[model samples]
Target: MALNYDKIVLFGDSITQYAYNVNVSPFCLGPALQDVYTRKFDVIQRGYGGYTSAHAKLMIDKIIAHENTPTSKVKLMTVFFGTNDSTGPSSTIQHVPLETYVANMRYIAEKCKAADIKVVFIGAGPFNAHQWWPTRPGNPHNRTTIQAREYCDALVALGKEIGVPTVPMWDLLMEAVGWKEGDPLYGLEELSAENPLTEYFVDGLHYNAKSYKIEYDGVMNAIKQAYPELLPENVPLRLPEWASLTSPDVLEKALQ
Candidate 1:
């Protein structure tokens, strides 16, 4: 098929990769956006599991094509990262220095802006360690909610500094899940399946169905505020609506 549609590219980590997963108990982020846009824009996912901003910078050129390239135009790009990047000292591979993370984020925003792509950043970290710590695979739990919050806060400010819009996932999730700093965890460690956060998180990090819904809501709100013209409801379909085709001639004209 010809690439006949403009796209909304979701470029980030595992969060982006799983945005369209109906198996995640339905109500997925990417699919919700795609459904609303339908024929107007393709929702492209470029999420890399375990990738940090440094890795993203290392592979930037390959991930984003130049304008000279013959391909569908990318109307908007949502950069959702920072989960793994928020890892603590034990995470030798995933731990990106705060300054470096900021620099990498800047590089990403600059490149996309130069390409004339509308950008939005989604800061998806500063996770709940109470839920994630016990599920760790090794000697040290490499991430903590405190450390994640530091990185998430940095990204939010960085977005404002660079004129790119950012969706503050940490704060949004905290409010949605109703947990915050210094709040007593239900346990010392090892959260049960039915903790205060189970409704939104699968493992204290990855999102469950409800979290994706919250994400979709925030994303749509950001688009409506910053790029209202790009909102799915505001965009026109690539083809005429079926009910509008009263005759073969009308259909032919619409196709042209």
Candidate 2:
């Protein structure tokens, strides 16, 4: 099929990869956005499992170049990282220095701006230490709510500095669930079939369908508040409304 609509690219890690997994659940954020913007914008998923901001920084230019083709224009991009980057320094594979994380985020936003694409930065979501810690006993559990908070704050600060919209996923999830800092386990529990909190996450770090709904809400809210002009209601629909057609020549009417 010909590429016919402007694109909204979602670039991130495992969470983003799963955001479009209908097999996991039906509340996939990418599809949800595509449905809302049907015929207007194509939501592109560029999520790589276990990727960090450092990895993203390395390939962002090429990714952008590939997406910015003659037929497909990138209208907006969301840079969602920090989950893996917040891993402890000992986890050499995923850990990126906090300073490097900030720089990478800035580079991403600057690149998107240069492409004339609106950008949003999503902070790391809350990590359930209690659930994830025991599973990886050999690896140190350095990712705490505290560490995630620090990274989230840095992203927010970077957004302000660069004039980009930021979705404070960490704080948004905490407040949604009535969680407070210093609470035991950060008020998050390991997900179990019988546990009430299971609706929020499949494990401690990944979101379930219900939790994805919250995430979708946060992202849309951020876009509406920060880039209202991009909202579907504000932007023109790709085709003329069916009711507006007065003649049998639909294509002619649409072109007009």
Candidate 3:
């Protein structure tokens, strides 16, 4: 097979890894993007479960190496991290200091830019600290909505400083569940598992199928607003429209 496909790589942690897993999440972002792009671009999932931005920074080159071919081009890359990196100091392994987190993100973005690929950053999603902490017991990787907000803000700021596009995952997820910042329990009760909004998240930490769909929409919206040219509507399809065929020489026209 010819390695000539333009690629859009989704690079991140568990969320990105499970993006293509229909069994786990019926709303698969990779497949959704594939449907939109059709044969115009290959959407590649490079998700590493439990990986922090620091870890990703170390492996970015290897992760992107396959698409560095002369015949293949990396058209866009989405860097979704901070879920694990936001782990508190008590969680030694996964915990990346806030300063280091910003630096790691910048490094990753710079690497992508150096490769001539457009990059977008996705902020961490919402989590229920009270529910999450008790479930994990001694695990301090349990991050609160407040902490995630800080990281998300940092990501947005980094995006502005570095001139990269960003998807506000934290804010968008909260909006999806009708959550507000100052409300008690961060308004967790409003979107409790018993609530209809619970369908968006299986656990308070990870997204379910419906939640993934919301996330997909947010990402597409970001791309549309910041890089409209990259939108599927603007990109030409891989071949001629089938409905336009009026003769047996359709294949010849498509090849053109």
Distance (Å) between predicted and true CA of 67, model 3? 1.3
Q: Residue-wise lDDT of candidate 2 within 3-45, one digit each (tens)?
A: 3678899999999999988888678788888888887788999
Leading candidate by lDDT: 2
lDDT of 1 at 141: 68
Tell me the spans in candidate 1 whose CA falls farther than 4 Å from its real position: 1-3, 66-71, 137-139, 180-195
- What lDDT score belongs to each candidate, Candidate 1 first? 0.79, 0.82, 0.80
Reference-based TM-score of each model: 0.89, 0.89, 0.87
At residue 47, candidate 3 shows an lDDT of 91
Worst 10 residues of 2 by lDDT: 187-196
Q: Which stretches of candidate 3 lie over 4 Å from their true place?
A: 1-3, 129-141, 187-197, 243-256
CA error at residue 73 for candidate 2, angstroms: 1.1
lDDT of 3 at 255: 65
Expressed as tens digits, the lDDT of each residue in 1-256 for candidate 3 is 2325788999999989988888878878888998998877889899989999989999999877877787788989999999888877877878898889999999999999999888989999877653454566765444666677789889999999989878888888777767666654452423443443345666667777877887789789878987888899887677666787778688575565
lDDT value, candidate 2, whole model: 0.82
Better of 1 and 3 by lDDT: 3
